[model samples]
Target: MSDSTSDFLAADAHAQRRYAPLTRVIFRLLLAGLSGFLLCVPWLSASLYWVGWFAWVPLLFALRDTRPWAALLLGWVAGTLCSAGGSYWLAEFMVNLKQVRPLLSTLLALLFWCYLGLVIGLGCLLYRWWVRRLGGWDLLAFPVAMVSVMALYPMLFKTHFADGQVDFLPALQAIDLTGAPGLDAVMMLFSVLIYRLLTPRRSPAAAYSRLAQGTAWALLALWLGYGYINLYEWDRRMQQWDTRRVGLVQPNDAITLGIPEPATGFTRESPPEMLATERLVAAGAQWVAWPEARYKGYFDDYSVRDSYARAITRHGVPLIFHDVERRWVDAQRISFNTVALLDEQGELAAQYRKMLRMPFGEYLPEPWSWPLLKGLTDLVFGEFLRPLGAGSEHIAFDLNGMRVVPKVCYEAAFPGFVAEAIHTDGAGKMLLFLSQDNWFGETSQPFHHGNMSILRGVENRVPMAHLINNGPSLVTAPNGRRLASSEAFNRAELLADVPFSEQAGGSFYSRHPQLFLNLIYGLAGMLILLAGWRGRSRVRRRGRRCSRKTRPTGN
Candidate 1:
């Protein structure tokens, strides 16, 4: 009886020991998912953005003993979860705003999530490959590889939610050097540090080395110092110029095409748009702005044109509005999505058309040219989408003696586009982002848009005014501060004193963006190739040694 009891106890102990590794793996996977969710969305609270700094630490530890293929799979799970969690609003928007079916919208969301998730999975695969090849020096290689992979990853799967990934402004000051991709590098570095602190190393070789810690710390210090200096320089520059009072006229009106509501879509501009602009100018606005695509057919419609002239003539202020112009040259019809600025004399001073159009939203891609895709879109949207041509030139409006760069809607998300515009006037530039965020409803997408768009001002040392429909017109200063923001989904106006810096240099980013990214790409590529070659050479030498040892001593 005693022997049987002992046997049973021994078997139970063995089983527990066998299942321990699996249990650890499960726990680590959960950690990775949680960490990924927190890092990319800051779903808990905006203030808890610090969680992103080391969110990938658990995943790094989890991948310690994983094969390259296994790492890819694990990464897919984590990345998919991360993408889905971050963009949960996309599904809601499709259903509520775009009127897509719930199931179909969810499936669309899933497809996009998986596509973006591949970047993370491939990064994991590459990480495993390097860890195998570099062995002890992997800590040194990690950040470099991570930065390159992340920088390239988003090009394949572009989404501008990078703000939630790293919210450290001192670190973000380095954006002029590496753009937002630099934040991903810092996040990877932090993950490595966290892993070193928490994970125990059983061998001297397995010990986490402080190889990149100096580079990381040096970078942080440099960024902070640069940020301080940049702000100081901007302040010095600001003192040289007079402030302009820019007014944002947000008419909180629901858009219903073919259905005339109080202040919606080119309805003689009476209920809100004209009223708001008039009030703002009366209150001492030098330039008043409106949101995107507010009027469907501006130039062709006499009433809309008359309304625009009436407002400018009465207010005696430059009024900016979302407009379109149709040109029929050589029997080819073309439409321009434009922001038209009317001078105080009630005449069109300048117009900036949208160059970068959204795929499917503004224009459909080649896939949608396929019959299947066309059919799908037709079914969902009730018709094939109108294809909008790209604008060739970057046009700026001269408002109240200041060069105002206009970014229509999602164009603000493109940093280079905005940078080019900031550099257009040579110096002393202000910015306006005419956006209609109504389609997103009350989702976190507006927050994402705000986070992504505000960074442009920081990069170029320019002040930005966002005149968004469905509310939340605001300004972001050069110091990365958001001010004078109106409430979302409300008919409100933001009149703020906006200042422009007379600094001649657009920014370091403008002068040499290609250099920074090229260096990163070249370094990352060489390291990978060199490590892989060394690994192969070591294998060859080991094989030769094994053959020699097995020669039987020539007996």
Candidate 2:
């Protein structure tokens, strides 16, 4: 239109052209590969979580200057690699622990990684579309699309039973309102902003790009500020807790559930679990928790019955044990990972059947129930393919002063499940998480599982006590502080206080879960629709313009 406007447009075109070299197929592949590896490193260790902040920056940079299709495929390569790297532990679990045949395990691993990669790839496609199609709103649109990618990650990426974006504490502090999806949004925003900040600009609106950079910094500042404020409040709230002394007994006796024999080099003769319980009571524990499948037989067996009864009556304290119960479900027999509470008077108080089963570890699919498959599972793989059917109802136990919610292993990762269990019975209860961590052995699986439990505790504002076979058994306060813990595979009894918050307030996340996420998902959907409409309108406009230009003069 105007000369100044023409110059501005030309400058924009030049700037856009500057990124043209990055569009080469070779460069796209390399950039994507590099990005995937970078993203994977931070998650490999518990200590390297800091790496996540900028891990996707490189990928973002590469994607920003490319065609939508090229960017999508490039992102797929990175996403696939990232998923595989984070979950490489699965291959180990299959071969070394479950001893699933190599070919099958590899195939399963591939399928899982690819599925996760597909989610990420699709996310990249959306990001490219939004940033390219949205004119004035590119800055805002990019982060929103990025958030959609990350928000879906927690729900979709289950191959490793992961929540990488959730584990970032600064972002996690705001999880009460945002839940997992919101935290993910914050992370994607940070990544997009960081890339934009680092990216050089030649556009006439470079000042606006710089402003976006400033906004990104401001957002980061706000996130950290709010996070620290929440942390301070978390501590202040915990200070007013009416604490109850609790004990976690780590027996170090581990068995592959449903396996006929136990792993070698384990404490063969039960590792004095009764002794550990006594130590817990002596250490001033009003109640003690035990690991899953803690004893050889149920309380019906005289030995287990006498020991548990004596522990309750002798110490005048309740003892909790989690064991597997077999039952018929739909005329098919399956085991239930169940927890039973023994009161001070040596009477059975209540029981909780595990409701949330780990996808692969616990809840194997029905297809594996075929006779041939079952035979292979027994002969080739000594471990159970499927140990249990999920429990139908939530159960809680009262320990004189307060009620305690019980969740078996793997359920700790599901924040909503724990929140519901606590909310159903009203607030002011501690969560007892029982586990046999032996299958994970000394890997990051145990650590990853434990870290996620912190999110659960904080979200519901509930204290949690974890007792594990082959532990690092721990007690986490409502604010996610570790009150007590023992080293893994150690014979020890942990004593800690269940920091029951005196504050009568519950978390917003508990009262209304997934509310923010649903809105975010809706917004993402709208943006996608808008992007599509805009794309079609541009195509139609270009066609009309070409028709006018190509019309023969007086023809």
Candidate 3:
């Protein structure tokens, strides 16, 4: 061949190689963005249930070849987009409110996105290391690893509720006893399996043939399993309590944080407390439940006491209203994450304070603690540091001969807290969930938050009487069927004839909390350790060879 011909071909090859780097970078960025979009899609108000699983595919691709810095940048952008889009409902409500400066509220939303990005980015890095050592058959690791990161990611945030699973009913049902962390793990594992099925194989024809066969079998197995399990557990639990008529009060008032609380969704001068109570009584509710912080301000004191007394005289049924904590001199500044219980006469019966606090959104536990200098924390994290002291003990109230265990706001998402509360009350207890779903607005937050109760209902084998400040006030039977629920994003109430059942004697979680968490941590730790050890050994071996080569000084 001529020299000119060889030179021309070599130049062309070099040029092609140069574009490879840029092409790879562009591909990673696009994949990252797409993954972000898919994650947010499942959170839309009208999203189909199956759409949530689409997120795992692009995420798995991101895990495979994404660069470290790209992992951060891409994850940050995606996290922000997903979080903002999914929970944009919060901003819609906040935009019209006068209490918080609009600019600050918007800033808070961005802050949430950035915070979640950091956690996910960390997960990506961890996965990169873990996957390098996984066995050939470890296809399941893709989903399991991603989900584990998602589940535990909330713990790093100031609020555990941030980890709450949204809209994944089957996943949440698994959480009733498995808890949020476990459910997250299971979802991620399944996601990897589904992604694998959808991915095209090296040979398209072979891949299609295998996938077709596997898919049919998988569908058949899932159908029979779901049906059999549902049927088997159906009649196992029998309701023991006498039926009670419960009225849920939904006042459509948009609450302005710093102002005097209003009763209806719109502005009204008189307190809606007494009026709402009278309406519920007139409606013939054996029991009435008000959403979280319905009255607001100074609830545990004398003025509030007199107010309830007057309301009770007019209403014959028992009342459950959320009380705002009175901030007084050194009163520990313990604001009530409270659910107030009152008898037919308005006499104070019992109360349950919220157990789980939203991270960064709720309180900043240790702001000064830093792992590495570059690891950034959220600014809004410490802003609302209203860490109400944890509720000291569990309390139950008896109403119309029924024992009721109460949970306030985010407490329903924490399986451990619910199980403990149920155990305190023993069998045949009705679980009453009082929540301010308004904080989450019309996003998946409220729906996901509300659905969590269904799992608790099934796990404890007790009926749930749920009252939300906004929408999705739901009633779930002991078997986890939704008996009644509010139309989304509206102020409404439901009267449900709940059939109570004895608390199930054994729960998978109750018998094994430490075992599960430890096993997960242990596995994660081992993977991390193995990766670190391999990296260190390589460094040491290289160092030894270099040392031997430079040993001329010993001669």
Clashes of each: 0, 1, 9
User: Per-residue lDDT for 26-104 in model 3, tens only?
Assistant: 7776777787776666545323545555565676675554544555566666656666665666555444332356687
For model 3 the local lDDT of residue 501 reads 41
Q: Model 2 over residues 1-555: C-alpha lDDT tens digits? A: 999999999999998798776556667678777878777765566566666667777787667656778777877888889878876766656675577787877887787787777666777777777767765355566556655665566442232212554345555677666555555566667777767668677677643555766777787788778777887787887776677898877767655434444234433233366667778788899888878844445533566566567656877989788766777778998887788888898787788888877644575555565776766646645655566678888887888757788888778766666667766345667777887767655666666666667667767767777777777777877666678878876778788877764344357887777677677778888887988899899999999999999988973
Clashing pairs in 2: 471-488
Ranking of predictions according to TM-score? 1, 2, 3
Count of clashes in candidate 3: 9
lDDT of 2 at 221: 82
User: What is the lDDT, from 0 to 100, of the residue 544 in candidate 3?
Assistant: 100
Candidate lDDT scores, in order, read 0.70, 0.70, 0.60
Candidate 3 C-alpha error for residue 414, in Å = 3.5
Against the correct fold, how does model 1 do in TM-score? 0.91
What are the TM-scores, per candidate, against the unseen true structure?
A: 0.91, 0.84, 0.76
Backbone clash tally (model 1): 0
Q: TM-score winner between 2 and 3, please give it.
A: 2
